[model samples]
Target: MENYIVIIAIISSIILFLSAVIVFVRFYRERTQFKILLGVALIVLLAGSIINVFEHTAILQSAEEFEQILSILFLPIIIFAIYESIIGEQLRTHIKSEQMFKGIFNQTFSFVGLLNSEGRILEANSTACDFIGYDNDEYKGVFFPETRWWKHSAEEMKNLEGAIKQAGQGKTVRYETTNIDKDGKIHYVDFSLKPIHDSRDRLIYLIAEGRDITEIKSTRLELEKHKKNLEDIVEKRTLELKTANEELQLKNETLYEKNTIINEQNAKLVSTLIDLKETQTQLLQAEKMASLGVLTAGVAHEINNPLNYIVGAYEALKQKDTHSGDEEAEMLLDAIKTGVDRVAGIVKSLNQFSRDTPAENEECNIHEIIDDSLVMLHSRLNNKIEIHKNYFKDSFVTFGNVGNFHQVFLNILSNAEQAINEKGKIWIKTTKNDNYLIITITDSGKGIEKDAINKITDPFYTTKDPGEGIGLGLSIVFGIIKEHGGRLEFESEVNKGTTVTVMLPQKGMKHE
Candidate 1:
């Protein structure tokens, strides 16, 4: 039993010595008061264990009294080490955490304050103190609702007092209210009171916070005012529109009746105007033919007598030139004959135009009629205008009023001649399409205006200078072509030129 006790004490001494060395090493590195206290306690324990081992093994029998004294000191030193390593460290950590929480609570931006359950102001952060122009100590013990922040407004104080009472009952209260700063300026505040509870769920403190909302409140009020104004304007305009609509409906009813009566009268007037225009056109044609016939007959009679004498003289000169064998005299005689023939041709064309006989089914050679018209207008087209004639290879014969067709070609060729200002061109093309003879006359003159082309064939609608033309020329042409079961179309462009197309039914074909 003694050996077993001595061996166990020796192992215990070794463990204590290792524990003491580790404690001393930690004390040296940390240099803390607790570490040094633990090291001293461990060293005392290790010394006691060594003395016990010496006594038990008889290695130091004279130290038996010292081992008993060390054994008495062992328990107190072990207790001291446990206290310094655990309990002391926990207490220091708690103190540091409390200091950090206080720093965060005071330095926040908003108005932050703490109140006891009795509604007394326990603590106010620096922001709250500076805003109300009060020192922290001055308002520390005052009732929260009666503090400097609420001194300017009695109503705000009553409201805050109620909120505090609610918060003390463990309820959170939030509201928008006004507060006065130190400079007496009123500021809108979003205020709240929140209750803090203990671990037992008992209300302990109230946390009061406020955020400035003066600018936000002002903007909201302005928006509401503008919205009200807009509604008023819209209501007024809607009423005005409704009244105007009712008046318009009444006017429309009245106008509808008047329009019915006016339209009846207008229909009668239009028919009368059309009949009068037709009568006027017939009278004009009759008078023009009468004058032309009389003029042509008188002119032909006066010229034919002299023309017969020249023809007799030319025949006698031709016989004399043949006997003398003179080429120059023969040429002179030929020239005289040519002049006489040309004059006779002009008289024949004028006679044709002057004829009042209307033969609606006369077989007319369109090429011959066009050639006669060109002959009549030779003086006007001699030097100033170029004439291009594209005749069909086959004969283009159409059944129409022979005299009327002669007058049609004459008036068209005359118009073409007069349209040329200084130097221009006229193209006369004749072609046979299906059972119709198509005649197209194009002129490179100053083109007619777009607005005037449609009205050109209307009676008395002239673009000529006064006393130059009666404007009945094209109207008469339109009438003659219509009478022969034909169509007339005019195409013109400003500053470009004009093209007139005439379509007349051929012989043995009916009008389409």
Candidate 2:
């Protein structure tokens, strides 16, 4: 027994030493408190085993006793260490997983929801709650119904429900729909549905993700309206421009027609003027023939008288029984000679007056012609009509015929005098500039009417009574001025006055 005790003591000391070393190492390593506490328990069991071998005598010296002690002391400690480590690790894992889930839910805008195969709501995230206007807990077991949002028909919802159910058969569906929230606001949502399967491929849950698109839909609608409005405005402006262009084209056509009519009228007026000129020429020739007829008669009478005288004298001389000296015959021949001389002088004067010729072009002083014409018409002027002259200091000479120049002044002055009836005045002026002579005649009469002044020089165009004067005076004046390469202008106002002006190119500066 003693030998056994000593041997047990040595073995117990070795086991306790080993356990202490292990406990020390565990503390230094900063291992689990449970593991360190287990090492301490092992040390206590080894010490108890050594004491038990002595206390129980020879019977306690059996290995079974040592084994029983170790079981009693160390078994529960090992189990406790294992339980503490496993339970603590599992608790930390569960806490970390919950924190991760909260972070993911808060950060994501994606609406997440879980549903059963029958479209019943199982669980939803906060984003899903916000979209449906429900608290996350309140929607955990709600059911989805076949109903449309904002008065749309339910057929669309029914179709979406069928698609979600079909997704349960190992497929996925993505679609868009409109839904009404708890606040009665309609929202457009784009959604994707997916089915979750367990290890055995059995349908477990349906997961759906959604994105809101209401603002996008509204923007599209507004853009469409603005596009339509722009089209309408452009169409209206196009119509207006078309109408304006049509009006301008019509005005252009009317102007072209008016121009054509005016041109035709101008041609007809020119032809009529030519006919009038020919008629005036014929009338002038007729006047000349009438004068020639009278002159011819007078010449025949004068010639006959001279011949009769000479013939009678000869007959008397022939019948006489001659005396060598015939004084009576000589006296009769002298009378016959006197009659012939008289007839010849009359014939010469008639020939001079009746001669027909064109105006002879020459350098002439119009002022001198004006003076001569005034002297000729001095007796015709009435006392009531005053005459004034404004002749320039420079001489007024032009290239023209003297007879024709005289005729022009005479016609104008006579017309002026006739225009002034009672208590009126006539003004005459002559000036030279730019190698041209300007002559002006003004009459303060019951002036020419506005309608008649433009036609005042046309042949047969006169304001006088039918026979008071032939209308040839102004016409003759116009012809002479035209032949001298001059232009005539007249200005008048009714009941105020009339002015006639003539412009003639200076001598050596004449142009046709």
Candidate 3:
């Protein structure tokens, strides 16, 4: 029996130690004031177990009194210590909660109230009292269903009754409503309702948190006004841009009209200039004719006397004896006939020059004209210079003034001949392809420089020794060809050669 008791005591002692160890471990981890009190209890229990071990029993002769002393002394100490810490923590928590509630409640302009399930006012923050114009003590048991907040409309009373019923049934209800204050000014409030339940899961009260939305409504109106003002500004700017665009278009149209007028004037001026050049060319040709006429008249008078004497002498030989009219007399008559024919030809050429009508228009071979011009220049040409005639097999003919065309060929040929200063060749080539008659007069002469080529065809533009050329030849040719509705093309290389091509539309051809 003693051994069993001892075993039971040891087991009880181990259980107590284990309990103390668990408490100490938990206390050490938590490190709260309550944990400090629990550590003291564990120490006292540990001393009690050690004393019991020496005594071999939990009770001694004074065991009851000792237990009573420990209970009276240590139990109160442990209880008092833990109780003080719990009270302090709970008090601090309650004070902080109250302070936070007061801070939030003061800053808010909304109403807040707490009601019990009986619909009686249980608690009311300051804003609630201010909104309802009542003190906390004045509405402690006042049911909100009977209050003035619900007195305005039956619908409001029904909504309030529904919210109370839902909260009593342990449900949260949230909605918006209007309420008139003590001053009879209606206010809109958005209120959120939360149900508070007891430990038994029965709803005991409902927390109503209300927020005033008057400022939000005012802000919405201001934003609408600003939007209207911005729209007006955009409309005004759009109108301004439209006006500016119209002005720019008007200016552009005006500028285009002025430009068109100027272009028309320029065209008329160019036509007048071409006409003037043609008139000037005609006058120059007339002057050359007058000079040639004076020269031809003097030569004709001198040749006529010589021709009359030769005819007289040939007749006298014929009238003499038939025997005397031998081989010598026959040769004299032939000589006289040749002299008379030559004089007649010179007179015909002189009469052709004196005629002042416009050049005769006809279809003529360009190659034949070039050959005739070469024949006239053959005696005067430099002996060292070569001549190349690459005439087309088929004749190139155009409907134009033949005299004018001939003059164009003569002027260009004369210019090419003068350009050659040393032993060089003159190349004349005629080509007919498509609708164009291309006549190229090339000279192996000092070619035009780059800077001078642009203005080479301009009137008075010349690169020749004084008294060798008057520079009017090419200008006259340029005018004549232009009057025939043709163009003169020039291509040259410095110190190499120069080529002048006159392109005219072929006969019987018309522009499509």
TM-scores vs. true structure, each candidate? 0.48, 0.37, 0.37
**Per the 3 Å backbone cut-off, how many clashing residue pairs does candidate 1 have?**
0
**How good is model 2 by TM-score?**
0.37
lDDT of 1: 0.83
lDDT of 3 by residue, 15-123 (tens): 8788778877877787677766766776666555545554555345445445455545657668866786889689879999999987886666667777887888777
Q: After superposition, which runs of candidate 2 have C-alpha atoms over 4 Å from their true positions?
A: 1-67, 79-95, 130-136, 146-157, 230-512
Off by over 4 Å in 3: 1-278, 290-293, 296-355, 382-384, 510-512
Model 2: per-residue lDDT, tens digit, 123-228? 6677767655665376556565432222353766676667777887868998877767757777887877899999998988888777888898889889999999
**Superposed Cα RMSD, model 1:** 19.2
lDDT at 255, model 2:
95
- Least accurate 10 contiguous residues by lDDT in model 2: 144-153
lDDT of 1 by residue, 203-262 (tens): 889999998889999999999999999999999999999999999999999999899999
- The alpha-carbon lDDT assigned to residue 247 of candidate 2 equals 100
lDDT at 141, model 2: 62
